[model samples]
Target: MEFAQALFLVVAGHNDRQEHLSRARRLVLKVHLSASLSEGESVRFLPPIFGEVRLIVHQFLDRLMHDSGRPIPIFNQNAGSLDRRMDKAEFDRFADAYEDQHRENIAVTGEGPEYFAEYKIKAFREIVDRAGIEVNRICDFGSGIGNSIPYFRRYFPEAALTSSDVSERSLALGRQRYPEAGSCVLIENNRIPVEADSFDVAFSACVFHHIPHREHLTWLRELHRVTRPGGLIAIFEHNPLNPLTVHAVNTCPFDENARLIFARDLAKRLQAAGWASSRIQYNLFFPRALARLRPFENKLGWLPLGAQYVATARKV
Candidate 1:
């Protein structure tokens, strides 16, 4: 890593007294997946801008560190993965029931597609900074109404952004809101209808949990194929350990706890697929007990901690 890149990562990796970074950095590998790089891929230009870009990530960290009054997200043990011991159709139907009931509120309100999207995009900007990533083709894996498109346009404006969704209705709604931002371009490409191993970054947000556990490996491996060697993929999910999150899952739309997959599970997922684990960071600190301590969650800061987590890895 270049001096500037290293500096930016260390800063982005920071939480408390730098000891947090010691733990966080273990999640964010200073080590690169050298074999994943092809002859044309080199870290030559990864330094200067990396530092400037990471400044954005630090700003995000600052905001997330502040305790939000909401209960931290929880792992909905009820939610099933593709590796189903339970009914796959029933699992999806349960989640879809929530989606169907409050389609408008869920899409336009609550976290406001843009709210979560903006926060998540900022996080990825940090990952790209550390990964020395520059992509020509990108996939917004859980492309929700194109909220993530702006982030890609701002950073990799020239790259083709392929937005995918299981539901066309959602994409249509997305186009209506963010037309100029390539919400429309997504339809021209394929999501369920398209071939695999196509795009560069298989950027996902809050979508993996909906996928049954059995299919996680296949889905990730397919993502690995669409990109060129050494490509980067970032996965964003709620932290099960957070406080307010617990409340959101039981009371909210899905009636399923946001499946907060542990970081260890995340590591196994990446390592199994031949990708080197680069950086996994904890964003929101939403402690579970804070559910009852609502008024105090934000004030205590250190009390109910971290409901959001991010995993950024490379496809080797």
Candidate 2:
């Protein structure tokens, strides 16, 4: 059977909205007609024209539920193609939907709110303190729901705080939760509305993994641009190599499209963005069952077995 025909046959039995089914049928016909094209008779069979076939196949289930209007632009031309950046509007839609779905427990995934609020944020604070970076003005990029507010207050009560994110719902909730944040900026198109060299300390927790890998260095450069020459930028991301971290992200509805990043990879991206003194420190080595072992996690920084890692670099 032809490729598009086979794909249509596979999806034909599924129950879906009429509009969705119509779109799917049209999509199938579009590809089937493309596949049926005859060779140019150059004594050679032309390579198959699979213009948007790959996209339809990947998003078959997604099309059944909601249409993203313009399908996400697929820059990859083949299986080996690497570019995966999404347009700003698409990312904004994703962020808005994700936050709306998980607003009640945005910070309380994997384990729960108590553990995330106490252990995870506390460990990040310790990492920051140990690095001994002075904090006067701080910006929490992608600070959804302001889960880090309490910890930021505990770590540097007097520092000016700014919470920024693409989701207005998240920013509203953050502002409600942490009134002390003088600025609750809504970011668009990866452009931070704040002035350059405005913050002394810029940090993001579990934010980069949600960003497409192709734009990682560009975002890092933005972080660097907004930070003072001697300021610090700390990035906390899920450790891709850790099984529990992998499972958590894979299972989390909000993280359905997330791509976990490695500590070394994050450090390299920061370096490429003109950051200096890049360092990676692994954390969350033990589950709550072995809470006492947490104290010893400091010594295991050299090990890459942690559930998450923090990459710290100085802006130059």
Candidate 3:
């Protein structure tokens, strides 16, 4: 229909085809080093989203002289009405569909510790692991469809878990997928739904960045409100330095978009929320482009703003 819509379809179609995911990762890695880039690289190999989408589709289809034998999945749209760029109510509407899409993708993609190794999930896992604080109670603040829920359960089977979001539908999906436990609780549309001074550790995965900076402060406040006075709050957010992040924030392809965020700003917001970082880690050190490069970015604490930022703060 519209240019952005059609463009998204082309890109998404290629992404849906499992074979292309590896190619996409390869290209992403290739562009990382200037020495690695091909001089006469044909733009044809580029994803359809790289150029005018409809034109790419037409040309590609004609070139094939028939269907490409690839079945494209339709785009998901529960968050079309929500604007993460807005100063308020970001991701409220879209979380359900967002969670659904990602949950399925993870299930399909996860082969082992490195399944979809090039993606962001592995980074989140590392963040959760390093934030190492044990508590009887756990809370995931922006637990989308419970992707983080399963990860939490996998790591912390003994702890009681709580998952909450502003979107009820998203929370419902988390409930559906999360292992049933007599001790767990699922909450929706309720900020800081957990009891005050309750949890020993509270975390949000791949969230924070989705909220506009204005609302980001409030999220920090809520993180503080729910945890015990000295409990820990961990936030694993997107890598600001990633080229894909720049593209998505500028052109997220749907009516909704991701808001731009940086670690310094996140730290400032945390301070404004009356919290201070006990431990801050910038993770997923090597950009997917540098997969061949050893010692991922976080291994070098010298560069704090390298990729993903995971901050564990104490409630103050």
Candidate 4:
């Protein structure tokens, strides 16, 4: 009778453990499916499912380790062939639907795409204004569809504006949208197609992440080469440390190939590319819901929790 009772308890414990694991797997799969659908990918695709399975397993192990009070091991999943890199062609394809897709992705923030674009230009203007530096020529690097043209005109009316991008289709769209903004220059072979030391400011907004990590230095060097002495090279990028920023990137179709960089890392890259007085400033701390608190955002630039960051440096 004692042996039978012990056997029954062991079987019941094993069944409970199995049930727990099954529940965990279902939860992981549900989350994975939601994310995949949001990204505009079909769950029926085998590669994505396989990737999700890997993530699910890792998450389960992480939870187990946490419960055991042990340090969790990180697993970096190589996207392999399943993840394709975006290039000029991809940008061209995205150009037509970029605005609509961006609107949809950022709907949760209760702001339009132009608001984001304008803020970066506004922030850069403030930085240079405080330093008493007058910008006469501005080069908008990776100026997709000339979204920044109106803002550039609004803030730096006297400065001559030049737009440059790798996507010809996007440039065409920009030309149509802003005929008075002049011709948009095309970048070829990672080159800016412009004279050296020609601009007072070389600005890029959320463009670097789309670029290959190995080629970041080359592009930074190009921007440095185009910027005159005492001129500013300010770049705005999505802050990966912020959960909302991560979600934004994950859902944005154009950001499929994005590899986010930390502000400190970008600052170091700027130094490596022969830039001087490099500084990092975080931005977009408060959403539209809390616009009343935005006045305090300027004082919070040192905080790393902002939705995006601007890494600024000067050529000297």
Candidate 5:
């Protein structure tokens, strides 16, 4: 009787150990699957048997998920790659869900993607109007899906608008959205497919940050080459100095590889690229909570605390 009781206890203990291991495996697999589908959350709980090995398991899972052939959520996909350039292929992947991702990322600002797009175009128009520049032809450089097309049409109805981007799929979507655009040019080999001195105004909305810093001068020079002498080159970019802007970029899936530039730094880059009379003006000073204070934002451009900044230069 004593021997039988001992045997029964041992077998039951073995079965319980097996069950724990099975449960732990299922939990790890669940976490791994979730990591593949979305940005992973913190691993807080594990089977008690894994007490000492919990940290090791976490590290192993991180490496495994990173190598799983998909973009890791909230992390730059190029972090481990040799080539860190944000190329056409990367943007092409983002083209389909660009607007939805953008809208979600900027939801904290209490505005839609369209609002941001329209505001940048509106700011560009105001800059040219103040300078008394007559823009007959406009180049929407880096015009992803032509988000600014409608606003461009609204602001400069008479100007012939040409949109350009590195991503073919984005251009396809843009064409679908706005067939009335004068032209959609594909950028190949890091070159804008247009003749020299083709446009009176070359505008880029929140595009430079995605570009590798080494290539900024090349594109800037390209923009300079495309714009007519004395024409405007206006660039809108997120201001890194703004905490809110930093948070927005950090959370934005598309901006995972973004390298935000200071307004002053962009001005210097513009000068080096053969642009003259470069100036930086900050905007979007107030969130929706302070909508009443938006009228005062224009006056605050010199403060450098706005969510974004527009760097404008003349091709002289």
Candidate 6:
């Protein structure tokens, strides 16, 4: 098929304003798939940007197909060249569901911390500090609505920042709210679009629980691929051991389907992904009523009953 024909085939269903962008992303994915399969043999035939865009689309398609319980059509084609499973209708449903919800409710102001502050951003900062990450390049993986940007900046102001997420709308707002970010990537899949060994410290807060358990390691490997040797990977998740955390996620609109992961399980996933010296720390030991107790909470690191816990490991 012609390039235009393939692009059109990839974006056939969408008739909205985003159809153009939809086609663009698919094209990136196609070119990326070709280059990946052909290796350097296809470099002369494709653009350099294909390498980056393919990672995003490949990840995106994996999520969509996995969710739809069907295979996406893109892979069946020569460019993707995998299986013959084709279900555009199922793909559309998954795509729509993946879009951002509660856009207005998730906003953050430059004057104050955003919605995540209630979870004690200070504890997250403490985890990064404890990880001993050098203040250089930082990647905020699954950076929903850019809520983590402010805290990341506070923790490593001099570090170059990149915020990545699946929802373009969320990323758009993230860029608007935090212009200091050098790159805002719209990630559709488990893979991060950045180059390998690109980040000094990579962090994701409350993102993994949203991902299916089966895909966790795949994404972790992606995180591992992009992180520099000896770089820190910090993963923060809701503590399933905490009843209050369960109640909150059950009630939260965005988290209706979230499966809160335990600290040990997450730590194991990190260990299996080739991360070394893995350490887990529980934080947010106090409710807002006991906010004053946060200071004392630091000394209670021995306790793993906090509302959330951060799993840190070095990419060795």
Best by TM-score: 4
Query: Which runs in model 6 stand beyond 4 Å of their true positions?
Result: 1-115, 118-121
Clash pairs, model 4 backbone: none
Clashing pairs in 3: 29-289, 79-94, 285-297, 285-298, 286-297
Question: Candidate 5: lDDT over CA atoms?
Answer: 0.77
Q: Encode model 6's per-residue lDDT on 143-230: one tens digit a residue.
A: 7666666666676678888888776766776677778766887675456777899988788877787665666888888899999998
Tens digits of per-residue lDDT for model 4, 1-316: 3323322332233225445434544555565556567664564555664664446343543343244432111111121123544466669999999989988999899899989989998999998887667899989999998899999889998989999999899899999999998557999887988889989989999888877666789999999999988888999998865656766776578877676776888999999999999999999988899899999999999987798999999888
Q: After superposing candidate 4, which stretches have Cα over 4 Å from the reference?
A: 1-86
Q: Is candidate 5 or candidate 6 better by TM-score?
A: 5
Model 1: CA > 4 A from native:
1-78, 81-113, 183-197, 255-258, 286-305
Error of 3 at 74 (Å): 28
Whose TM-score is higher: candidate 3's or candidate 6's? 6
Candidates arranged by TM-score, highest first: 4, 5, 2, 6, 3, 1
Where's the lowest-lDDT run of ten residues in candidate 5? 2-11
Greater lDDT among 4 and 6 belongs to 4
Mark the 10 consecutive residues where model 1 has the least summed lDDT.
Answer: 27-36
C-alpha-based local distance difference test score of model 4: 0.77
Mark the 10 consecutive residues where model 4 has the least summed lDDT. Answer: 71-80
Instruction: Provide the lowest-lDDT 10-residue window in model 3.
Output: 71-80
Which candidate would rank higher by TM-score, 1 or 4? 4
Residue 270 CA error for candidate 5 (Å)?
0.6
Candidate 3 regions with alpha-carbon error over 4 angstroms = 1-132, 179-190, 248-255, 287-296
For candidate 5, the TM-score is: 0.74
What TM-score should be assigned to candidate 2?
Answer: 0.67
